[model samples]
Target: MDPSRVVLFKSLSKTLSPALGIGWIVAPPRWTQQLHRADQVDAQPSALDQLAFAELLESGAYDRHLRSCRQRYRLRRDTLVQALAKQLPDAPVSGVAAGLHLILRLPTAVDTRAVVTAAAARSLRVADLATYHATDDHADHGLVLGYGNLADSAVIEAVRHLRDAVEECG
Candidate 1:
């Protein structure tokens, strides 16, 4: 649900008479009645606005909007992967799906904190895997490359810088 839906629900409940909420497993007849009552009282947005909001929410608004974003991220991630593969082919890459970041595990001997500090020195933001887990020992040294907040050019450059940082440590 959108923020507006939440606000409208609150406003409607406050302004109108309070009623018991139907349980999740309500019968079809009672469910329809509840929906009808809600329609009478709910502060609904315009149909067109609602449609647009839904499109935006699902990331299926238009080809151009979705395509450009997908393409840009794909390229950025490719750049990061290529650089890492070239620099450290033995290091594994994981969790490169829908999320903003991809994980790259470094050599077991590498210091994860040192990688974080070096990336920071290069003006790159990254999360060391140790930050997410309790024990740093036996865990791989790596960085999570976040592509969502970064621009395409920035991502390419950042990945290049990352490659350099990793090479420097190695």
Candidate 2:
């Protein structure tokens, strides 16, 4: 790929905080200059956010924080996976190796919407897999569960509740 044809976009919002909304672009000077000119009419990220981000980078705190986040999320993911494996042995899970969420596939006869409703009644939040699709509206029924903000200690209980919900609805 030609360097001139490629531009990289980076954002601190994803790694840092969404409220910060600090981001930058990497491109050839000509492209950058055009962006710079357009930028004059567009709003920029807050100076305070920029300064805070810079300080975190300069002090190496950003890297440390990211590493800490990775470890915490990994543990949470593992805990969720283990609990689900033991609790919902028949419900196949996927996309667990990365990201904050994973998919729990249900039986073909199970009603995905009903499961979502049942889970909500049990105080467990989950999404129907079909909603993520653009069409068919009838294939690959499952739940999209996020373990990101779930407490490590509560993982087992959550899975248990989810199992009850699945069994009840499925």
Candidate 3:
């Protein structure tokens, strides 16, 4: 890969706090001028915010926070995975290695919208995987299950209801 063709966009909002309002772009030297010009009106973080974040980094607090977040999210993710596996053993799940969300790919014979509707009827919540895609060309038949804010105790019950919904809609 050519270095000139690579550009990286990074933000701490998701990892840390969105209120910090800081992000950056790394592009080849020549491309930077154009990118800067195009986003001349973009908001910049305050000097105090920058100093505070730098202190968090320098004091190792940020790293500690990241470790804590990872442990917490990992446990939640594992709970959801286990529930899904036990309740829907044949469902194909992905993104288990990392992240706060996972994708449960349904069988081709399953009607995604019907499943969503049925889940809603059962007071279970699930999203159609296609809703996240820009177009049908790249969409998959599945559900996007997010466990970021789900209570650990409720995971199994949720999966049980989800399984019932899928079975009802399939």
Candidate 4:
């Protein structure tokens, strides 16, 4: 954890919108110089976007928006967690405390792909946690449920669909 060697990179893509495509980096003086030189050849974000982001920051709109987003996401996460606990009691739901998604860990006998396929057939999209692993040996059987943008009713319905899908797979 050397401070000088560490570089912090952040973007408005996640907090604001991906369409904005504006980001910044913080690094030591040497690295900053190198990055500045590289920026000359690399594609940079549009000046209009940069100015808009600056305006948002200066006006405190960005902070207000972020606070609202955090509150909304927290409520969504809680709803999802409660629905999963009630609908899929046997399965352990993890990663609900933070982030935009929750991980539902299935029993070893349960096939993650089958559940994913079944859910997809019901118009419910879910990510397989195994696909995120670097190697097959380290993979785990689980589903990544993103509830950030989903309403409370949608969260409940999605979990019910997931539960039904898992039962169908079993």
User: Which stretches of model 4 miss by more than 4 angstroms?
Assistant: none
Q: CA lDDT, every prediction?
A: 0.66, 0.87, 0.87, 0.86
Tens-digit per-residue lDDT, 1-170, candidate 2: 57788888888776777777788888877797688877763667778878988999999999999999999999889888888888888888999987899999988778889989999999999999999988985668799999887888888899998998888987
* Per-residue lDDT over 110-161 for candidate 3, one digit per residue giving the tens place of the 0 to 100 score: 9999999999998877899999988789758899888877887888889999
Candidate 3 residues lying further than 4 Å off, grouped into runs, are 1-5, 27-39, 132-139
Better of 1 and 3 by lDDT: 3
Which regions in candidate 1 have their CA more than 4 angstroms from the true location? 1-64, 134-138
- Cα displacement (angstroms), candidate 3, residue 74, comes to 1.8
RMSD of each: 10.6, 2.0, 2.9, 1.8
Model 3 deviation from native, Cα RMSD in Å: 2.9
Candidate 1, position 165, lDDT: 78
- Candidate 1: the clashing residue pairs are none
Candidate 2's C-alpha lDDT? 0.87
Number of the top-ranking candidate, with TM-score as the measure: 4
Candidate 2 lands at a TM-score of 0.89
In candidate 3, how many Å is residue 131 off? 3.1
Worst 10 residues of 3 by lDDT: 36-45
lDDT of 3 at 166: 92
Clashing pairs in 4: none
Q: Sorted by lDDT, highest first, which candidate order results?
A: 3, 2, 4, 1
TM-score of each: 0.59, 0.89, 0.79, 0.90
Per-residue lDDT for 60-167 in model 1, tens only?
554565577678778888877776777668788998776668888888777767878888999988888878777746445677767777776675578778777777
Q: Give lDDT: candidate 2, residue 144.
A: 98
